[model samples]
Target: MRLLVINPNTSRGVTNRIREAADAMALPGDRFTTLCPAYGPELIVTEQDAALARQAVVDTVRGFKGPCDGIVLASFGNTGADPVRALRPSIPVVGIASAAFATARALGGPFGIVTFGKGLVPGLQAKVDEAGLSDALLGISCVAGEEFGDPGEVQTRFRSELEALCADMHQRGARSIVMGGGPLAGMARSLAPTCPIPIIDGTQAAISLIRAVAAPRGDHEPRRAAAPAET
Candidate 1:
């Protein structure tokens, strides 16, 4: 299957991180094309930023001409997913927030989200409510001042902060944790091993979920030729 991963933000750095995570999660025979709008905020931290990114996503997807079996909105905020899905009903759309939350629910308990800033907490909470998973959500924790530049540097700089947040979530009875933000994909991979509970990277979860939904099913078989008109 061919998947299109859209990072609504304009930051090439964040887009690259999303692409790396998608590529790592892609199954054999699956192809992923990752893109970002040429115009939008470098990072979507506020409502206005998200709004702009949403419009940009719609424009970008509408203009895209290549084959896309599925689309992954590669942002923890799930920017423009609904609009794009409405615009292209035939194509499957998966958003990182929804996918990660679903994966957390499947893991069987209350989950917490670790995001970049407090400003995003309410938005993420709203998504949990929208998914009808509010009961499964433990809470949200923020790690402020994390930069979206060089993945390696970002991961290194925020490692301690993320670890602390995860520890707090686990202490607060969270059975699983979602590391929100597409730019934080590398950090999620790095921190997962040490985390006591499952650490779901939203980008990776989005990729996996989309692929599962898009994969061909073999439950039905073709009917045999109608008995040759009664031999």
Candidate 2:
């Protein structure tokens, strides 16, 4: 399957991070095409940044004429997902955060989020509320320091800190922890061994869910002429 992954932010580094992470999870026949907006904030940390990213995402989707079976919004907050779905109703569109939350819910317990910026906490909470999974969310934790210089380097820069946060969340009763932000896409796989609870990565979750959602089911095929209609 071909999946279109869009990063609302304009930072090429972050876009590259998303691409590498998605590529790492690609199956033999699966393909992921990742891109960033032509113009927008380098990184999204607040509602204001998201506001701009929403437009950037819409414009990028509008301009891309590639073939895809599904769309994955790489931003943790799932920026511009609604509009993209409206733009391409025939294809499946999955947001990273929505995918993460769904995975956490399916895991059967509350989940926590670990992100790079404290400023992102409110927006992430808003996303949780929007998903109607506020009850399932335990809490959100941020790395102990200012935002990083390069988003692509976050996984390496804060590996230990992120693992500690994951451990803390597990101790606090969280059954799983979501590694928030596009920059931290593939970090969970590396940290999972040490983390007491499950670590959900939004990027990986989005891809996995999209593949499932887009996969063809025999039951969904149109019935033959003699088949009876549903009551």
Candidate 3:
């Protein structure tokens, strides 16, 4: 299988990190390709960035060409997802947040998302609500104390802040935690130890669901072949 993962954010550093983590989940027969938007905010830290991510998703699908069997939007907020669907209705475009949330629900629990930016928390709530899994979610929460666009310090600061947020959520009622972004994929497992509950990273959830949706499955195959009539 060949999966195309799109990081709607403009940060190549984050894209590179996502590419590495997502690829590791691929089975031996599968291949994964990752990309970042050439034109968009470096971080989807605001509603404006979400709007731009919608445009970026459209542009990406219009320009993509490869043996792509599945499409994964690399942002946790499901940025650009609905617009992309409007542009390319038939394509199987999966939002990372939606996918992760679905997986967490399937795993069965009160799930919580720990994301960056104060501005993005409401939007994340909207995303989860839109997915119709708000009932399954304990809540969508944010980790404060940093601006996502500060690329020079974003990575390290994001890690530390995410750690604290996950801990707090665990203290609250989050039975399952989604680390909540492509860039933070590598830290999901590490946080799980400190967390009293399981951690569901976007990469793991995305990859697992993508595989499930792609793989052929059924209780039984069709036993009858189509009949050809002689004219």
Candidate 4:
């Protein structure tokens, strides 16, 4: 399937990280085209940032002309996913936050979220509530530290802290933990061994969910009548 993954923020570094995560999650014959809006916040951690990203995503999707079997809004909060989906109703749309929650629910237990900023917790909670998964939520943890010049380096910078947070969540009854930011895309797999429970990468969840939903539709064709049997 040909998938379009949108990083609502304009940070190329974050976009690159999202692309790497998408590539790692892809199945054979899956093609992912990842891009960022030309204008928006470098990161989406505030309501203002999300507001701008919503318009940016809408503009980006409006301007895109390439073939797309599915679309993924790569931001963990799923910034602009609804607007983009509205613009392209024919294509399947998967938001990383929603996908992550769905995967966590399917895994049959409560899940927690680990993200970059404390301010992001409310937004993440709102997403869970929106998806009707709040009842299954364990908690949300935040880790903030020295800023990295390259946002993509966030995962490495907070590796130790993230592992600790995941361990805490596990003890608190979380069966899985979600890495909850676009720049933290690939950290789940990287930190999985250190975490007692599963570390769910929103990007990977989005990719798998998109592929599953798009496959049947993309491969479907009008049925043809079988040749008449010879007497």
Give the clashing pairs for model 2. none
Prediction RMSDs, each to the true structure: 9.1, 8.1, 9.0, 8.3
Q: On a 0 to 1 TM-score scale, where does candidate 1 land against the true structure?
A: 0.85
Extract clashing residue pairs from model 1. Answer: none
Superposition TM-score, candidate 4 onto the true structure: 0.88
By TM-score, the better pick of 1 and 3 is 1
What is each predicted model's overall lDDT from 0 to 1? 0.78, 0.83, 0.71, 0.81
Residue pairs of candidate 4 with colliding backbone atoms? none
Candidate 2 lDDT for residue 188? 88
Best by TM-score: 2
| Tens digit per residue, CA lDDT, model 1, 46-140 | 89999999999999898787667788898878889889999979868988888888899899888898876666677888888998998888888
Q: Residue 186 in model 2: shift from native, Å?
A: 0.5
Q: Per-residue lDDT of 50-157 in model 4, one digit per residue for the tens?
A: 899899999988988766788889897788877887899998888898888888989978888888767678888888898899888888888865444557677777
What overall lDDT, based on C-alpha atoms, would model 1 receive against the true structure?
0.78
* lDDT of candidate 3 over 81-138, digit per residue (tens): 7777776565467888877787777778688888766766776787778878878878
**Cα shift from native, residue 53, model 4 (Å):** 0.8
Model 3: what TM-score? 0.80
List clash counts for every candidate, in order.
0, 0, 0, 0
Candidate 3: stretches off by over 4 Å: 83-91, 146-155, 215-231
